[model samples]
Target chain A: MELQAIGVQHPAVRQVQHIQNNTAPNRYKLFVAEGLWAHNMLLEANAPIDTFFWCPEAIYADEAHRRAEEIAARAERSFRVSLRTMEKMSERDKPDGLLSLAALPRWEPSDLRFGRTSLVLVADGVEIPGNLGTLIRSLDACGADCLVLTNRKTRLTHPKVIRASQGTILTVPTVEFEETGEAIAWLDRLRFTVLLADTDEAVNYRQADYSGRTALVVGSERYGIGKEWYGHGYQRVAVPMLGSGDSLNVSVSASVLLYEAKARKANW
Target chain B: MELQAIGVQHPAVRQVQHIQNNTAPNRYKLFVAEGLWAHNMLLEANAPIDTFFWCPEAIYADEAHRRAEEIAARAERSFRVSLRTMEKMSERDKPDGLLSLAALPRWEPSDLRFGRTSLVLVADGVEIPGNLGTLIRSLDACGADCLVLTNRKTRLTHPKVIRASQGTILTVPTVEFEETGEAIAWLDRLRFTVLLADTDEAVNYRQADYSGRTALVVGSERYGIGKEWYGHGYQRVAVPMLGSGDSLNVSVSASVLLYEAKARKANW
Candidate 1:
């Protein structure tokens, strides 16, 4: 194994720490993915890795060590760091000793490919990284063709999102647009019907049709869909909330809606 | 407004800090609820309050101060703590200048009252406080009759769970059983059909019958339902996952299932 211990002051460690910021990840074109699960996901997705670091003693099981070695073999640069050093570079309180810095994969609006009965998810101004990540996992689980983040605040490679998504971010085809208008135009040009999860003047989600090409749009929890989305030929559907907690968590809302679409698609 | 300023080293502040642990909240029969939203929820539910704390500067609007004063009038004792003290006592980084120590309501399994067509949630060994909180919110939104926590690890009044639940924890009818066997026996005796959210040998959730008295149970993400639950004649149902991430977040899973039950109940 070509493993050499690196110091806390290593440039690679510094880079990983700096990339935790909102803009630095995009600026550096690098992001951090930690833990054995995320590492395995990166390996499964065959994501490009710039630097891979692991602590020898931290990996307990022999099989896990073998897998870590296999992952290290695929990386451009590999190093062994002290447990303390690993802790400094890790985002989690309990570090699993596996950390990777990989080049961010770029996906644009034009890159989104839709099938005859495609299902897409549009995150219109989602702010929280954990919520955004959970939505990505749900979107991927629902087999959505693509996820488009409009009026984006959090970077696609945010560590909290990466952890919360459990590496689905690496596997799912996700893209971002600066403005919701761009996303709207793309949907319009693709002949995809838009369904907004709005509470007012909306039909029950079960009654809404998701038989053909459809894009399910969910907005921030605090604010409903933007006013600009109203005039368009979009149908608003509400997930029936029966009690005082008037609004569901954004991630939960997305899951129910996507699964409802899946149910309709299957004729259930 | 009978609001007196309290010091950081006050007994009440220390007491609040002590109750942050798992056992202390229940031992003392007290739990902390922070922010205006939770405060309002407690008032709406007419929950018993021990003490209410707020900062003068934290109350931004005159109307908000008036409401705080009205809530304080109902409390046994009311005090205004400095912003610094409030920050220390508050669980959230952005404190809304409202914190309350309230008497935790005791709800036993016997207290669970169900209708003829009751919908119930059984969180079997759900460990994460946030996930549990989100489940409470979703369960409340779907108008489930009650939430029965089986083999629960976290206290019902954990600050993180309360915040994540968006004060729904204050309103939802919830009870806990130390053992899964007890929960199963309770459901069986009540003639409530048990629907376990198990991925193995499970039918699609849509196909499961939630027509009459039903108790939908979800397990921990790491370890699913225990083996003891197998021979109880519980129906196993799976939420169809279409992509690489084989499992949905526990909270999201519960929301979709409860909403499905709600949809069926309404015939939508």
Candidate 2:
């Protein structure tokens, strides 16, 4: 395959840079996945790659070079670029020489399927991209079905989210609701047992029933779950903080709760 | 009390910048704590503050101002600086008008007192500062007795660690061993049931006994635990990955295992 050589200022390269910088108005429509881990995961998941860019000089690892060839074969459009151009396109200090652009997977409430043993995660007002990504990774690790973001502060396509998620964001089904009410309505309609993680709550997380259809809700670090989330028949659960620190990190709390749910559901 | 006014180039200010930038040779001797949470936690722990620097104009919250006065009263030396100077010295884009320098607490194996039901965490070769800090925070939340670092990569006093730990690093008794053998010898003498988090292990974490004196060992994300850590009678435990992700974030894995130990020890 003859790969077209491109420079830093190439139209496609500029488009990728714009999307990465979040300077492009429709940035959320497409996302950039960089380096070896993301590339390998993308291939593992069989996700469609719109375009692939690789720097022969920058790819030092044998596995990376092999993956680059695989990506080039599968990508709709593939291009070769200099190491300098690759560095300019990469967000990390050290570029791994492979980058790809893919359309953001759009999911809706209707798209999510709930079964008798469904486990859903609702993250409300999570401001940090890295935290949101970590939440997705945890949700995935616990075998959760879907993620519903209410008052979502960061784009799911944000590079940090993709990187921190280790590309699990591509596998997990996620939807966003601008209003918390809409999300609540959907969960209610699905007959999901909603569990809100509250620091003040008396019921310990392990004590909560997680069998059957369950939805775990976690909020931002600074301002917790919205007040509207309360008085909605949702059970409040707390991870016991036995030390001087008042609360665990938001993602840490979510993972603990999710794992508890996982163990209970599995009867482990 | 008359507050000493300082310029950006003031000796104390330069010293802080040097420490924050990790440019000073003795950067590990003193750590910088910034923003409201760090300030409040530092005071709550009664950790000695070597110096406090405040920017009145940059402080927007009423509680911050109140805390400023309290910090000034307790700090060995206090200075008032312009917001520009504060921003220059701060690591975050938004400076919170409060910063402090404190001597890093040093602990030895002898300093740690293990009880019958002690929970100690051993983090090996954790390269990321934020991840290390998060590990400390999770260890604190689980009410762990102390943190033992073997083949430690990042400095515990790094600003990212301090911020991510929410100042729990200041309170947690942490000792680092350059050699894994020394750490193993100490744990053996203390009769701690060592549990290493391994991806290849078949023993599920929850099935493992965490009662009595316990130590949970987690390794760097890139590299698993050191080779010397194996064949030492330290039982290997694994968190079941029910989804596509091969492993959870190192901190997340540590927290889940720590909480599991916490619950099992308490018989919850």
Candidate 3:
């Protein structure tokens, strides 16, 4: 529980700057957040944050101080650092006093098993960290199976994605693949219906059966799941968008589909 | 069309950074993104956008270009800008030159009149811009009857929220309310079965009878519809979030409930 302010300024704090970069290929073993909510999320998640420093100047809500004290007590070690050190590592314009690096929870696809899987979501070519995080959060909310990802998309190792996920990324297991076709095939082998979302689909999403193990595939908003993969066993299913606009944000679209699937199967 | 670079270096953009900042209330009269897919949705909606831009750097198939050009052709006026401009406007570091701007659309609550008024979505205290946008996008996808917005949240004129709505905001005749409780009373007088989303509600969302005229009410995530106003014939309902953590993000939870209503009524 050693206390150290990890910022991008000081050589000691700046050392973790590489981890802070969203573009980095590997996940940061430690994540330093500037806000009270994020730090609390990590603490509540029991994420093994090795160390954290509470700044004297950091604002505390009514519950925040009590929670911080409890988190500090539980920390194998803790630090009471100065606001100056936090400023050195503060990535944003506003750097709060409480900075902590919680250990990220490890996950795998098998960990996402659901009872009688209805409509699970699969994402490919979603390269934006925030979009991916939002997608994961939606998947978790809609009770979809693991969000299968492709290497071509942004990996969840990024801190922004975790923040955007609002901490749900820690809960949602993912299945990533170099070959999306293989991923599709794997879903096919499992007898799960593969439904690809596109504008030109012959079947509307409502018409598609999501009452069983299903893989709803959504592509990057920029580039949809291309015909190369589209012609596979997948059935192109489009949501019935009656508006002038033809599509939803990738994550929102996925949410609609997931809600439909869960609703039907659950008879909600 | 007269094209203006209006460099990011230009001071005008940041003059009054937050349009919602009370002094800047007039900002709504200026350029505003009005629909879901405000960026992506506008294309589907053929919403009148000033231009189209994307980061020329991201790797994508020809479909991306084809779609971009298609959308541009449909815009009120269109042009191709550079990755630099795209980067400045887009949050994602990798610009897709898909940036666009359009005048916000106007709305009236009466426009949401539907068949037997079986289901509808009413959002109050929905302060988060992206959540509002995402909700609009989902409302369109889930085919909810009109989206209602009250004064408790971000201004609908914000471009980011419109972009998130994916053009649904453009299609849906959303009504604005200064007071949500008053609006609920109006719907109540109309005989709509009002359902309030509560984190502590005992009735599971799936158990609700969505077959009749139903109004789905949701509060802001940060401060859920304050407890002060409740129990006035507004049946409180809750979504069964399988995960043990915090409740679903507001937008996700709303989408789930909306689609569940869609499903039960669909008799799926």
Candidate 4:
């Protein structure tokens, strides 16, 4: 294995930068994981890495350097780049000297599998990459089996999504739907009880039954859950807003409901 | 009342810019609220506005214009400025033609009042402005009585804090402590049960007693609760983390705990 030195104008560097900017059409086909935490999680999951780029001068931590070395050894292709080139390819003001472009795990409706008493989370029209990522983290914390994104607004491969999720975005089983109707139909076929977080004609979230196969649905701050999700047999539940705030942050609402569902299901 | 025309070089403009940059020594004495949502909130709360600045050319919405007029009529002082000058005074890239410099509500430990079965939140060492703001929004949502910030890193008057809080930061009675020991002693004296969100020797949060006068304490993501807070008869409780991530976002954790305490207190 040889360390090929690349400059700021290198095609590979340009490609990563375009992917980071999300200018590339195939951005969803691949994603970049920067910093030691995301890279360690990638290695821990043994996810396939298309390429690894490192700059010894940019990394400040010994642990990051070690992880970069480990990644260089294991990556299918590895490149050594100058600090300037690394900065061009990095998202943060300070580059950690390690970056990996890896294949994003793609799942379809058919790929989603469920068991008895399965827990699933459906995030609809969540625009903020950080919020989407935080929702995924909450879903993971509740030991939810899968995340199904419908009416998706932000790319799942967004760097903020990966970082805010604490790298669980790499490990969590996630699927996306192009249309809300498709997701509703699939969940209905699977007999998963769809619970929509709504403010009107809704039961207290605590009083709602989360037992059996459950799919907790939350919407973005701008738009409540889509109109398509309504008029269906889905149960509507509301977290009590006792003060001046119109509602809780979307991620906060989702986490509270997810934990409640998990507790009720486990009889904790 | 005639509106005084101002320029970018005006002392008031420079003072606001300094406060926005958090460079002013008395930054905590006044805070800026930008855009329509925060302005509407301030008006709804009847919060005192020391000064209001509006740009006719920059405002695009009719509702915003109406709100600006309403603010100008009620504000102690109002100014008309050029769009470029408004941009200089505004935080966002595109200013909504409204900004207010208002006196930050100052509360002290002695000012904190509680009722039987009161709910309070103590954020210890939370450094992120947005996280602190979101915690305040959650506190408001949970109908918590007051917010006590100890080991505070970011100013409560930070622009991001005011914005992220959805203006609840203005209404939520908040008090700050210079020392963690002072907060501890005050809570103890008040007979408020202090529950620390900790991972060690902690019971499941769902099983914890949130019935009496409860103060839910959360710490920064970097540092857990201060060591001084422990071994002082404070209860330790943990939200179950059933994922690869080490912990949830500080705001998410705080919101979950706050809602749980609220629900338990209301017997919902």
Candidate 5:
């Protein structure tokens, strides 16, 4: 594998810096995934690779080099940058020696498939990228049908979100809706029972029947589910907080509900 | 109420800076809790608060000022600092304008009281302050008897841990053991069923019986339960991950198990 030498002033290098700083516009549709695990995830998901950056000194493992070689082979462009250049491209204090730029996958509502026993997670207005990413991992672990991102504050492909999800964000199917009502209406048309996680007249989450097609609506930590989602015949269920906190972290709450549904359906 | 004026050069101000930077030694026996919610939790828990700092301009809400006044009345030392100095003392981007220096609570093995159906979360080798803080909140939410900290990489009173735990670190009883063996032996002497979260020959987490006195042992993400934990009469349980990622975040995993046990024990 021939490694193309690059400098910090190169357009591709600048692009990586932009992506790391989150200054790059969405028009680029490019994401910077850092570290070996991310490289493997991009490979496993067959993400469209635009470029691969490597630091030979940092990648000591033979298996890692082989995987990087494979990635380079699959990419349209690849380069070997100096450790200092790699440092500038990395968001973490310690760069993991491998980084890749992949085109974000586009998904439409039709791309999702829901079954009679499907569990879909509808995230409404989640501001924290880390929380959204954690939710993706939790949803994926429980085998949720797909995540419908409605009223999202951060892009599904944000670097922090991608990293926090541990690359599960790449595999999980996601569709975005600008309005919560539109998302709810789509779920209603699909004959899915929507359970809004709210404190009003809420029942223990375990009591809510999750055996069949279900959609759990999790809201932001501050504002909660949009008022648009209220009074739509959606059942309100709460994760009982036995202590002083009014709510659990949004990600933790979603995971608990997802696992409960999975357990009831015997998905594990 | 008269404001005790202070400036950047004040000795107390220097101490706040040291605590925020995490440069203060354990010998100081002081931790800073920032923001309004943390202040309230400190008040409710009756934590030994040594000092309180307030910015009147930031305390706009009537209820907030009342709470600040209440805190000031109870504190041994209280001062009003300029907004600029308050910003310097805060770790948050937008300082909430309230900071408290509290004496770290000391606990021992004898402080823990377990019921027949008690659920205890044993955090072994949890290296991240954020993860430890989240675990404290999760365990508190599930009404776990206490969190036994063993093989901890970060201090339980780390500002980030306290901030992440939303000051629950003060309310939740925590006893630390320098070694994992000491923690395990204590659990054994109490006849607690130690369920270690490991992927090796593990049963489904949901399939495990968590109805009785149970202690779920959570390990670090990189190096799971130390080798010393093996060969113990402990059951290995796994939270199934159907995604490309290997495991859930440590805090998320422990919360799931803690809630499961709480749900089973009907302790909610």
Candidate 6:
């Protein structure tokens, strides 16, 4: 079993131990399971898991071990490992003994097609791993159809992301585009109204038409949107910042925009 | 200068010697000025700065450095550290050469009086320093009057909170509460309506009237606000989360709630 190869004694494991540098997950269309919370969240999301690992510490006594065994019995593939090794693999210092390599969630943006108009989030060149995770979580909570990442510098398959995303990346239609300008052009071709959140914009976010097939485009925290979208025909809206700060976290901005869209769509 | 004792030797002086850790800044109320961008934001926000540590590798070589010099000149106290020491103090290994130590801003909540009604963010028992920082940043961006942390498990003085706020903690009004229940009672006595964002609440956040003196209360990411408010007649409202993910980042939830309040206040 592939599970046996991951044990500490196995020599092949060391070569590919770094999940960030490993392409096997994407190549084989597999997603690494994180800690127990992510495992449980995936199960709750009904996303498929291919293999499961149980670290020794995950169970306290014989009774708990029996429960762990019972749960493992439900999985098609499962294994047991020492706490030390599992802790090394985990992002968190202390992890519940369970981890799983879930099957890559098959995602399709076309599935987001709604009969009525809706607001969607389009992230342009978001390089930060944590921000990507937070943005996906926000998109899912606000009922956005899909989040399209255009030319991300950070690898989507990075293990840090899967851990940070609370496994919501599985449920969200996580798609990517080669270039943001091209993505915007495709949206324009589809006649989807686009809005850019620029600090220099005149119109307040609340004044926009978020009830339709509106797409809110946000850029990286570092460079923001480049020459691609500037002075384009898209409406530029800014959240009314009444105080002294320049901007909010890129992910928090996404959440605020998506929530605003939800509110406007529902006509609050 | 006290800065010399630390022997600032790093490239981007601030990056090599970042005050990102709670230990450094919390101990002395002295934080390392991170980057030109951050320092610029600080200037725009009118945050107090005690000294400036300039490095040659930094833009001081470029004409842009001339403008930066103007800002540096404004520092109440300033120093010139060798690029070597700047590198030592810098966290960014490359070392842009400039590191500044600024006294943490001292600000307090103004008299809790709203002439024409208002919207505010009230955080309760939030333990994550990053979450608190994000909350403060969102409040600053959304134009929320202030963030009140009552019954907080994490110190508002933690450096992660400062870093997470992108330095807005200095610009925003942050008040600590001995007890969330007591704070709510005080608000009630002062005619401030308390809207607690609870998971079990039936009322949608949008449905609530935020045009009044509103305080949007959020519990920690762990267990939310303690049930003490349940005894009080506080209005409980939650943002409508329409997805399978049961939890959102407490800060993300705060952003959504704050913006809703912003929208209502604008209309009001």
TM-score of each model, in listed order: 0.95, 0.94, 0.77, 0.97, 0.93, 0.84
Candidate 2 DockQ score?
0.80
Can you tell me which runs of candidate 3 are displaced by over 4 Å? Answer: A1-12, A23-30, A59-80, A108-119, A142-145, A188-191, A202-207, A210-212, A226-228, A263-268, B1-22, B32-103, B108-115, B263-268
Worst 10 residues of 3 chain A by lDDT: A1-10
Interface RMSD of each: 1.0, 0.9, 2.9, 0.7, 1.6, 1.7
A best-first ranking of the candidates according to their TM-score comes to 4, 1, 2, 5, 6, 3
Query: On residues B1-268, what C-alpha lDDT tens digit does candidate 3 reach at each position?
Result: 2244454454433322333233454533334332123455555555566544433354255666556666556665544445564445555545453555554666566655567846777887888788888888778766777887764667776666755765566776677777766786668777888788886755888787776788888887777875545767567888766653566677877877787787667754
Worst 10 residues of 3 chain B by lDDT: B28-37
Better of 2 and 6 by DockQ: 2
Q: After superposition, how far is residue A52 of candidate 5 from its true place, in Å?
A: 2.2
| Candidate 6 per-residue lDDT over residues A162-256, each given as its tens digit | 75566778887766677767777767766678889887854878788775588888888888865687767778888777766667888888788
Off by over 4 Å in 4: none
Q: After superposition, how far is residue A23 of candidate 6 from its true place, in Å?
A: 6.5
DockQ of 1: 0.82
Residue B156 accuracy (lDDT) in model 5: 70
> Mind giving the per-residue lDDT tens digits that candidate 4 earns over B51-157?
89988888888899889989998888899988999888888988888998887788877877798899999999998888898899999888999999888889888
| Candidate 2 residue lDDT tens string, B1-268 | 3698999988889988888787877734798889898888888888889999989899899999999999999999999999889988899889998999878778878877778999999999999888898989998888889999999888877888988898788788898898999999999899999999996855988789987899899998899899999997778999899889888999999999999999999877
Which residue pairs of candidate 1 clash? none
Query: What is candidate 2's lDDT per residue for A1-268, written digit by digit as tens?
Result: 3689999889989988989888878634688888887888889888888899988888788898889899998989999999899888888898888999976677878877778988888999998898899999998898999999998888888888987888788889999898999999989889899999996855988788887899999998889898879998788999998877888888899999999998888878
Please give me the DockQ of candidate 6 compared with the native complex: 0.62
Interface RMSD of 2: 0.9
The order by descending lDDT is: 2, 4, 5, 1, 6, 3
Q: Rank the candidates by DockQ, best first.
A: 4, 1, 2, 5, 6, 3
Question: lDDT at B268 for candidate 4?
Answer: 90
Best by lDDT: 2
